[model samples]
Target: MKHWTEDLDDDGDEPLVRPYTITGGRTTAGRDDLTLITLITAQSSSGTDTSAERHALQPEHRTVLRMCGRRPVAVAEIAAELDLPVSVTKILISDLIDAGRVSARPPLAFAQNGALPDMTLLEAVRDGLRQL
Candidate 1:
């Protein structure tokens, strides 16, 4: 029996979902099964009915489910694997924690040791893009 959580990103900036199996919740033996999910919300936006977005399990969650299944993992490792900034990961993880979908420590320690590149990196990236 194992539980894992993953933060998956969509095409846009806003995060989509992290699939998980909560212990003692369902699927018996307190073991959560690896299951795929699809969501559909009947809400409309700007007078237009938007279809639900589809996202696969994020790499972090996929790794969690594959390895730990029910073990706890640090947010730092998760963000590292996903190659996302700690602040963004923190926000996503926060939502997951609030939703009871994932377990995480507070204060977002993962953000402490993180380093964000200055304009140099951005310029380099931009320069490279210009070359292409």
Candidate 2:
């Protein structure tokens, strides 16, 4: 069988584009609010100029919009789903948020406190597993 990389047209050794190129050489997401666990969702009503703005966006930006358009999703999850680095994903997401195409909020408050799972629930789960 042919190697997966060999299957591509000649010059398969070269990547189509570098990761940094996607962010226009910017290393930061440009927003302090975005974090790995931040939750993001598409806006229900993207005001008037949204269409033009969307048309001008890179394909990566469009992909991020589609993923969050279905429902709220965590920033890390988005990165995983798209196979992009978290920092790069954050930059794309921040751009979308700034354009009013999406909304972003911090992770759930409970996770912030580093609380442990309830022992009672853990015990119940263990007991249920034992019964099985």
Candidate 3:
């Protein structure tokens, strides 16, 4: 399959291109050679094609996507790269997962530790977010 954002993102591959804040997605039918992105828009707008806030990816989320594009990065990795607490990253990654923009599966046992592994980000973050 072709990459959705490969050539379409004419802007250089810097995470700075995306705006921070705003969240939501748009769903489109399968196209031959296009990557689909979903975005959230403010409710009351003119019926025409005016722009909404959530259309742009946030810098943090954009960096996460860029990292994911390079390889399958766990949510913790995203948190670490952004230097955000794991709880915050999970909230963001959860949005991505819920929107079908990303997927989550159980983590694997480390080469050193053979314990049955669980989803690290979810486990590590859940305890803290429950307090907030």
lDDT of 2 by residue, 93-125 (tens): 988888888999866664577676688999999
lDDT of 3 by residue, 1-132 (tens): 878887676665455422233223222212221111222211232445324533554666566666776446665567668766555566566565555555554444433465655778768789879988
User: Could you tell which candidate, 1 or 2, scores higher by TM-score?
Assistant: 2
TM-score of candidate 3 relative to the true fold: 0.42
Best by lDDT: 2
Cα deviation of 46, candidate 1, in Å: 35
In model 3, the clashing pairs are 24-39, 24-40, 25-38, 25-39, 26-38, 26-39
Each model's lDDT: 0.41, 0.83, 0.50
* RMSD to true structure for each model, in Å: 19.8, 6.1, 17.9
Q: Kindly provide the TM-score of model 1 when superposed on the true structure, using C-alpha atoms.
A: 0.31
Q: What is the C-alpha local distance difference test score of candidate 1?
A: 0.41
Pairs clashing in candidate 1? 2-69, 3-69, 3-70, 6-61
The residue ranges of model 1 lying beyond 4 angstroms of the native Cα positions read 1-68, 106-132
Question: Candidate 2: minimum summed lDDT over ten consecutive residues — where?
Answer: 45-54
Model 1, span 39-98: residue lDDT tens: 111112243322321134344433443332344555565556555544444444444444
Instruction: Report the candidate with higher TM-score, 1 versus 3.
Output: 3
